[model samples]
Target: MFQEKNRHLPCFAHTLDLTASDNENMKPLIEKVKKTITYFKQSVNAADELRRVQPEDKTLKLKQSLPTRWNSVFYMLERFLMLNKYVASIILSDSKAPEIMTASELEEIKEFIQILKPIESVSKELSGEKYIYHIK
Candidate 1:
């Protein structure tokens, strides 16, 4: 028999991804947030301009989600929420801001972040080399 450490269990990250994707409410909001990221990435000039316009904090920068990586969506939303004020400023100045989310949509994003936080923490735990909950 192989060593105990040689065997790998089911991937928690993949399970989390599937579970989140299966949620009907999250589907549309994830797409909307992805679209917002795409809008900012579509033009280097506009993205650079936004960087200049926002504060020096790195968390204020927008992040795009990858199609295959579930955690990226969480990071994207987290950063987007962090940078909302600067994002609003950019939207006010740039005609290419794509579509602005309504107040309700913003509230939805906030809710989504709350929903994802636990999974995000679990994913982080599973990714570490040390014992789970090491940082906690």
Candidate 2:
């Protein structure tokens, strides 16, 4: 549809983003993470339970990824991995916790994070004000 109106659209980046999001290997894990985040955020008692499981040193709350922002997923997963143990405890302790990820799923998330790290860095670089090419 977009091509039908104006074919000049530079959709390479958008294509990449879509590929990453819809990849067969990642779809399930991403959905699970999204569901988990949503469940906690929607319920006050669940959020409180998650906080209780975390150690005193970590005070950050779980964050959900914005549907429109690709990097937000990385940020969300990064924090989620950091609080993995606490999250697991919350799942075990609360009967209402969203579907728990398996050990393999946790490992896969870590791998996905690593895959996205360089892309995230590139995204930051592209958004910076510094000149891409200083014609000296």
Candidate 3:
């Protein structure tokens, strides 16, 4: 409504720019995740566990994985959960079985996940899996 009086349907495309500056006050968890995942990959058991505990995306839905090596981008705030889960499975056994996160890291991850919950979720159904609302 602000521009040209509805000339466009107003598709909202702006995401908060997280990387334009390294505001340490706001983004330390992202840095922590990158470090944790890097450490997790240093051993074989951890790597195998990451392969096993993926969210069970049977449909072969793909995602950009950890870089062949870590970099500044690996520490970006956007992909923290991918980093978090990868580490958790690797370091923790599958019985009780999720790996533990440090208290502060867990808190930050929860906050980010909550903020992102509205975007989309993958679901499975008789028609096969796709992103959809929980109809039940």
Number of the predicted model whose lDDT against the real structure is largest: 2
Per-residue lDDT tens digits for candidate 2, residues 1-136, read: 4457656644444445545555687877888988988888888987888777767686778888787775777888888898778777777777878878899999999999898887777665555535544334
Residue 70 local lDDT, model 1: 63
| CA lDDT for candidate 3 | 0.44
Error of 3 at 122 (Å): 23
Provide the lDDT at 6 for model 3.
53
Residue-level error in angstroms, candidate 1, position 62: 1.3
Q: What TM-score should be assigned to candidate 1?
A: 0.76
Clash counts per candidate, in order, are 0, 0, 0
TM-score of 2: 0.78
Instruction: Give the poorly placed runs of model 1, Cα more than 4 Å off.
Output: 1-9, 57-60, 129-136
Q: How many backbone collisions does model 3 have?
A: 0
Per TM-score, the best of the predicted structures is 2
The residue pairs found clashing in candidate 1 are none
- Winner on TM-score between 2 and 3 is 2
CA error at residue 76 for candidate 2, angstroms: 1.7
lDDT of 2 at 25: 78
Candidate 3 residue pairs in backbone clash: none
Tens-digit lDDT track for model 3 on 1-136? 3377557432121112222223365356555555555555464665566666666663121123243312223234445454555655455654423336676767766665555343322111222434433444
lDDT of 1 at 83: 72
